[model samples]
Target: MEFRATGADEPANDGRYAWAGTKEGHLFEVDTVELCIVSSRLNVHLSPVVGIYRVGRSMVTLEESGKVLIWGTFDSPDAPQLAGTFKSQRVPDKQNFYAIVGNELWTSSGPVTKPGSSAVSMRSPQIRVYDPTTTGSFSVLPRPMTTPESVGHVGAVTASAIVPSQDHLVYLGHDNGFVSVWDRKTYACLFVQRVSPYMITSLVGVGKNLWAGFRTGLIYVYDVRSEPWTVTKAWKAHKETVLKIVVDPASLWTDETLQVASMGSDMAIHLWDGLLRDDWLDAELNLRQPDFCTFRSIRTLCISWNIDASKPQDLSGTPQNLDFLRDVMLSTESPDIISFGFQEMIDLEDKKLTAKSMLLGKKKGDSKFSDGISSSYRLWHDKLVQAVRLVMPPECPYTVVHVGDMIGLFSCIFVKSSESATLRDVAKITVKTGMGGRHGNKGAILARFVIDDTSLCFINCHLAAGQSHRRQRDHDLVDILEDKSAFSGLGSSSPGAYAPGGDGTTVFDHELCILSGDLNYRIDARRDNVIAASMDGTFETLLPYDQLLKGLATNQTFRLRSFKEPVITFAPTYKYDPGTDSYDSSAKKRIPAWCDRILYRPSDELANSLIPPSGADREDKITPLPQQYRRWEVNVSDHRPISSSFDMQVKSIGAAKRALVWEEIESAWFGVESAMIAEARDYYGGG
Candidate 1:
């Protein structure tokens, strides 16, 4: 059933002055480049603004009461003045999108209104187009369908997009699985087509075809090149209502891929390869045949830094998070790749709980609060640049790439600048299984790439907070690992194969997986004893009580029995007061815990005799584990970020490794064979 429609937005325009109107009657103009609000103003219209549009040198804002307010957007010394006010006598639908044509604002404000008649219903077959300069309005009705018996009423128009090739044409999607092409010049419905019975929440026009996303999480491609538009294809795109569908700008000229990206209410964004749908479908069905980009091996040094989106400095006036990250990047030895996972990269401002969180901000100007980059991500980017330029060896300078976030949780990867020439097929995947339902307060981000010839993956996740949410926390962890299976995201399925499970559910699926973030696993120890343990350096005694470590051992989550985690030696990394080593003494008195962590899972075996590094071998100093693992006592956020530096072993991709990866893929379905033992020795030395 369709939801009861509320306020509607006037059709949006993509011109020089991008306009956004809030519910409080405040209008803001934002620059596309700087990605921040450049200027803002309030209007006399007290109703919530549902739509904004840019028409020539003027801006139009649509109010809830079907009122249109136009203001001059001139760059003169004088402030913007109200240009005109008009009413189409039409209300907007929150789920419907409108477009523009020939200086007119087209809106799906509810049912078509007849001249002098005021019956308004979502089931009406007509749409209203309003002229920007005048209150003049006209109706565009859908052509009749099923002979003369029934008019082509397409439920409520939920989504719409401009057809680039034909400016006079627009695509309209309805809640009852109806799609139609409406002609602005002739006021005729070119054709009406019905798909699955689901609401079309979003639509995007790509080339001559139109893409539509439905509330059922399905996607349909309409080939509108010929006289009769045909539904070319469909795919299951998401698990929840598809909120928006956007074409990859790069898809314009590239014949290699007709890629489109989408975000749904399920708290996840999906990247689809439109051209390679068959290959994707096949892999989705047969997970073993996932053609992961095979590489010999890749080594990565991973550090998880919680830059305390709220106050990132310490009492000593040091940007401790930045210092910790920079220092590690400089001192960490030759890792082909480096990744940093960050949590709370922006201060969550719930003013009722406000405590004046400080941030590393830009000068008061265009970049101020620019996409929150000033206070949060930019710090990580700037620190990496400084570390590479000032500290890293001249020959091995690194170039940083931001694996951005859906919420504030983010992850980034740094690779040798020199390797850019040889590195190929880089992919990044970000999934937000938000703990706060669909709001994205918690989730995971991943960056995958092949450096030289080795494939590596870096993962960062923020799970559900608090001790009582243990089950929810573990579920989020398992969700990320499972959702990322079988090259389901980014560039292509890696060319390599994971030896242990042959399944893609875990990062163990990668050659070298370094997963980190604030896991929020609190200890049950008494606060006094926990504080004393930290002060007396007997914190290791609390290791047995750590929830995350214990959870992994008992449950089937991660199922990574072979993955290795370095022993932690630092004090509890949580609930610290900003700028000091003291624990939280606030009213809530949050318990201290090692919430921030870094763990690595190495690939099982590259060759027959490789005998992947494990347990007992570490005592001999030849182990594959990190050389150091400890917490950084930088009292920046309530949680002290931890760092791990290690030199991992990676074999170069060659004939031997290639054969083994393919062999493992086949073995996944066929099961182990006696010949595998003999074949292992031939490819990998039989250790």
Candidate 2:
């Protein structure tokens, strides 16, 4: 039951059967589908088995003691019979000492007896190749009989692979992080490149790409075909040392998408897109295929308000006698996307209401309500829908695509009726930072959906209250973003549709992320000065004192620093007397702070598209522009509502045209070399 597989090799071409060697010198036959041991041969070797490989019909097993055993075909009905036994031609450590390429066996040719000044040691910086088909086993080629002196201390060969796209070339990764490419026939070292200071742990060859993993958990891919071999892409693949890397056999030697995966000491395995072809493909379309993909400049209106449990009737009593909801909806001239976020939809200060909310909350699968506990949510939702329909052009209708409610916090998204048909993969999830995640009094509601190929996320949060709770609020916000199960509901969705930290989606996974709610950050200044600034319409002077802005400037871990917020020209929206334009008149007189705010992080494509080339005209820049960040004087709640309108550029790609562009770009970029690589892979049977 505690079997620790030290090495494994899949001999069956169908991938249904595998043979694993363990540290106890035991060998087991594994049924890969059921992942269980089917047969076992105990104490097959005198020492720990380090590597196993299948060459033609022979099963090759290597041990740490330099013992190699060749077995009869495992597909035979009889128990495994030792076909032959031979000593390894090189010093063996634990693993990665041997590899099977075609019908030849590739292993180290080492312990060459190095005479050193201090001590006599033995280690090989070169590999030996053998063809078992020969009557007497013999080296097929000279194969780097010795490493060149100019290469320096290349160290012992740790990992090696035959380049699939160029079968005549062999790649070797060393303990000193030096990578050397060899000409298989001539045994000449073509080049030696030092990739990292740390040891190279794993190497995978896919076409002209060589993916190398390091002891520092970093992964780098090099274009071996380039003149001065350069890293095409590199990323921190894990938090700990990477152990191994492999390419999916199915994707290799074919036009199918190549998947390169890595295993790390952190006990996590990750799969990556080899060569990042899809990303490059999309980038090509965005940059060169103008006829296939066009930009649509759509307006997005975001509003954040803390209603303090006030009903819609309170707005009717305002002096202007105008519909505040209708005015806010129409302020952006019928925005294509409208998001309204409200905090304190149910008065949390009321003990009875809070108790009822805690006792009778929304059940599973209930998207809208928590029984009758939060009636204000229903009223507010209805009022906002009514306002959208009342103000929009009669021909262009709107649809309430989603509504997420958490007793005291609510969020609703409305899109132009015609654009609603483009919405897909809609999902909403809630995170409770209240009472250590036992209650929903303080937390966030996140809604995410894909429009065509782009994904967007809206987060409405009510952070911890009180002037001294800034750290707590920061912790809560980070928790909401890092929550592992936040979007577990999207498991049934397509693969690679969303990737947060792991396999599920997080707030950061979306292309465009909009954050709004009662963030509870205050303007850090004298209460009197803040009030004076608000009264004199000099709120810009007080912007420097805003805690959120301060965090963006000073805090290294502040995640919102990446988001862009429109300049704050309006007065602070918090601590006002209900039904009046007055600051808090209560005993605890709270300072006037901008608690409710809106911020957004645009997609990299959109941001990059906005930048014009050198000497280009300003009008040529396709940028997402933000405007009209202001507050409404509804005077119905302690916090005035803040709103902003963003003119964002969205991509609408034509499939048939995109395919034509893809073919054009791939042909021009990869040229005839790609075709040659495919033919070479097939001839070598590298897959």
Candidate 3:
């Protein structure tokens, strides 16, 4: 605990720079001088305000969900106007979205380095500036590779701040310690500079001089005006990771009264008069400590299902549109995340379905009717979105953050506006396990995303139909579970979920994996007896009769070692007559069995990792399985939609705690790298 607080607030790029964040999802504007929120608004936005900048006429706020709103700052407590909003690249943005109304600098980081991924390569598209008004954006590429071996992997753009130079240039920082000064007008690389050997954490600029904070507490002063940026001064400033550095943009370097403040993980904020100071530069051995507060860990979890609508023509009937959004919306609070998976969204006869085979055979090339299948998919997706919005309350605004389809299997994910701030590292992968080897009548899609630093995966799979073809169904399961693309990480052009395995590959790699779709497992019992038991509420007695459950348990072929499923409390969900509540009374009197269902399996380490030993025991804090995991009453399609809900624990360790943890990791990383450098020097010097 430091007497002076280590605030995580970031300084604005504007001349009258201010900091804005949220207290309970409402807006808070901090005065740089007072170092406290000056204007706290009354109008509450459920979406936590992750970013805010004061530009020309209004203050622009970027919510966690990537929603950008331009608000009028004239009246301190006035309602901000909603400005143009667009989706930025998905990454674990530690509130890393930096915007200059002149030109916004934000990062869309590469995929999370899975546990066993190879060392990350440098030099890729990581940073960019976009105009909220325009549809296009300019990419800011990093400096050229300087050596065969470099400290940074041209990886994530760790930190960036708008340089208050004459042109209002953007000073971009990378994990690799390289810096680039770029022209906002042409986005041309103006010059490159490497000021530190350690990782660059944050940057601030005043006139011609740039101040950079590193993972080590060292701060570097770079003269940006020099052809090759030159470091004028370097100082060990803090006892921990330097979280942020802010200089008054209006102050000139020559001004003796130039104000600069540095905050660090040390829990102490230091106010330095100017860049050059020999006074107390070393980390203080004994500092006054600030009292720490108890932190709470709890958040929302939701599950939804998409029942078949028969086809596009019948979407509006049965009044066929009973959607699953209502089950997902939390009554006491908003679900931090929601998942909706569709069992079937396309037809076997559709031309797009056969296009893959045709292209490979050279019989017909890709269709020029770019509008054909995609346009239809869009139309269907829009319907789903519109239906979801109808059930949402005005207070809790949510949006479709991700949408993907693998042939007939479709899934969409929605995030509440407030929870979008921490949303990042989203990637999608698809694999076909249907017929003709590569072509499909069945396949699956795995959408992986990171929310609140927790990895979650949703798999929507459709297996081969027909009761006798269980072998093919099992093969499809193996294909989906053992997908080779998952190990490719973000390197492959086609990244998808792999089967559950060690070292975090595929869906098994995520902290939580939610699976839903038509598994097509039938009851091995006589059809008549199965139908009778279903009617008599004797599902328990018929449990053993389920071929899918029994077969999966015994068949090592497709059975993942540690996956789990909820107890089937609902009636059989397959082979029903369209537009009727009755089961298939026709020729294929499908033995009533739970086919369309939802289940979840946690990564082996998730439970142990999330539950701290001092906190509630895993069993006590565990959100109990949802009672509403029953089937939806909608009867538009042959298969009933099953929706289940769960509460995922969100460990919202505040920024202060994160800074402390980062300090440990950074210190360890820096120490190891420094040791490696020394080892290399020794080896080379001896030779």
Candidate 4:
């Protein structure tokens, strides 16, 4: 059926914004730039609107429900009228109505039936012909007698194309692989061809041949003139069902050029040029597969001949001249021509993963305590407490490694490097409570890294002691463990009991993860007591923490000699006062808690792997004492750097498989990255 034009200015083009009508009879406008829904309204038909096209200032909508509505005014809005309507036994799958050579408006409808539902029976495939200039009615075209009776062959006609030479039409797709052609005027079946048993999903006319894409991942080129429509070329072009195909004639002869682009359920876009004899021979010999070049799905493919004076011969033998073809193909870059539907799915998955990592910091302004005293107060007194916490940026890449009072400034450092041993300061937020106090509010940052595909590394950092402030510290730690806003649900709480300071399920079934940080509470405290006292539990206090950190020798990357005492590498960082010279005097030296530590949770495979014989011995648990303390060093905020090594193993097979799937996912939604980002902004209530 044809729609009468409703007087409406062609949809307002705010650059990338465009309107579309679906087969389900829905009118929607998408922000071409943002890929967001600008507006959507359900029109007349209950089923999806299958095809939409614009002529002059008006839009023509065709619905699968056999109802067509014309709302845009061809001449004026007030003059809008019902253009035409057609009823059919089956819903139309593909529809195209074009003005033929004469004033006659010829319309073609192929087999497109609604999905089977419990309440409705399946519809048979049929084609409808219409003369818009006549009474504006349609009738089912006579079916070819040779058409198969099986549902596979007579179900939905997947595709239809009008031959450029005449009003003749090619209807070559099926729920089965049967392809048939007919003369529109005579209703004569010229040929019937079956290229494969697999269902034909798409059809494209290139030159004198017809290309058919199959659900079985194969493509066949048919010579329509030959009896029974001989198949000229056939190749396996995809790993999954082929969804759509577009032929680019201009790229037919270029070196390793792409003559056709196909998208499939696998989320990959495959590019193909006509196969060379050698390539086909290799495939036949099982020596090589067809040269199926794959691109990220976001890329749309189209053909353009080199029209510039420098390469005029590129247009030879094509139907259109170089300039005209170039104008047609290059008017919209290949990237813009193709569209996809699964971007939302991929984006949803990405958002889900990002949320998993958001719980790495304490909620705003929560107090943290260590030992039985307030670590916040002690750090504030020492001028080491900075702001107690800082909100992480939405897209911050570094995983928070540690956060605590460095002296009195709230200091936090994130593990900036994903490769090896490297920690960098991501942010050092400073908070001023009053004239005398400047505290650093470094939010705890935690990250789970994929170590060579199969393994992950979890790094944690802890800050020095404080009694009553331990509760806040515990809360911060818990926040880090449970936040899902960052990595989108990829992170979880410590796997175990939910008691404060006790370890819960941190990593489950994941290859390997290392949960390390400055767990302030001693490793021997009871979980319930720690929770009641509001004290941050130590490494030995929580069952999982104790099991993971106990017996793991500390890797001290720095050392200090306090009060000129015999070179000492280990000293409690909190007890030293800058004014007392206790750090410089030789008479009395105070030993303090081993506040800085690093732990490694190596899997069995990694634990058994031998350390490289040439590198620094992995046995160095204590860092050598620095020869002298710089100005910042004397107070330099207390904690020393700690480092460790892991014999992380690579799982090549798993990694390769993951890479393949990832490539497909990326390809399937290639151009829609910005759309996905926009969706995220919307989901997060951002503009």
TM-score to true structure, per model:
0.48, 0.58, 0.46, 0.30
Question: Per-residue alpha-carbon lDDT of model 1 for 443-506, expressed as tens digits?
Answer: 7777665554344667788888887787777657645654322344332343433222222333
lDDT of 2 by residue, 1-687 (tens): 112222124333245556788899988777667878777778877788877876555567777886766664423333233323433333334334576665566666453455654654444355666665444444445543556766666777778776676678888888876788878777678778765545888888876778888876767667677544544544567777889888775565555446678999999999987657654554455465367766667778888888888777777776542677777887887688999988888889998888778777766786545656557888888888888888888899999988988868889899988999978778888888888778898898898876655567788999988887887877687667643225644523532233222222556545567888999998879989989989998888998988899987765345565466777878889989977789999999898999988887744332211111223222321133445888888777888898888876555657788778778878765654456446545744555
User: How many clashing residue pairs appear in each of the predictions shown?
Assistant: 18, 0, 16, 97
Residue 528 C-alpha lDDT in model 3 = 78
lDDT of 3: 0.54
Candidate number that wins on lDDT, 2 or 4: 2
Reference-based TM-score, model 4: 0.30
- The RMSD of every model to the true structure, in order and in angstroms, is 20.0, 11.8, 24.3, 27.9
lDDT of 3 by residue, 1-687 (tens): 001111123223223334346645565555466676555554344467666654434455566665565444322333333322323332233434354524343544442455666966334334444444333332233332121223334445667655444445666776656666556565555555554434788887644467888876766666566454444444456767898887542333234234578999998788765433221111110010111123233343434333453444464454434433344444325555667777555455556545643344322363222333344456667766775677667687777777876545667787777777666667777777766347544777788766553456777878788877777776676567542235324312211111111223445456566777887777788887877777888777888877777764653223432355667777777767877878888875676667776666633232211111122223322243656567765667777777666555433224475456445545654454445334433322311
Ranking by TM-score: 2, 1, 3, 4
Report how far residue 337 has shifted in candidate 4, in Å: 52
- Tell me which of candidates 1 and 4 scores higher on TM-score: 1
Q: What does candidate 4's lDDT look like per residue over 1-687, in tens digits? A: 222232344323312445566655767666656768755666656777665543433445556655554444334433222332322223244443222212222344434344664543333344444432222334333431233334243444666554333236655466655666666667555655554445778877654567778776656666565443444544456667788887543343233232568888889898764333322232222111111211111111111110111112323343433233223223332221111000000111243322322222223565443322233333322221111112222342234343433212222333323323432111222121111222222233233333222323243333323433443443343233322102322223321111111112222223333433344433344434433332333312243332113322221100100001112132322223432323323243222233334333333112111111123223221121232110111222222222222233333223344345445545544344344334323322311
Cα lDDT of all candidates, in order? 0.57, 0.70, 0.54, 0.36
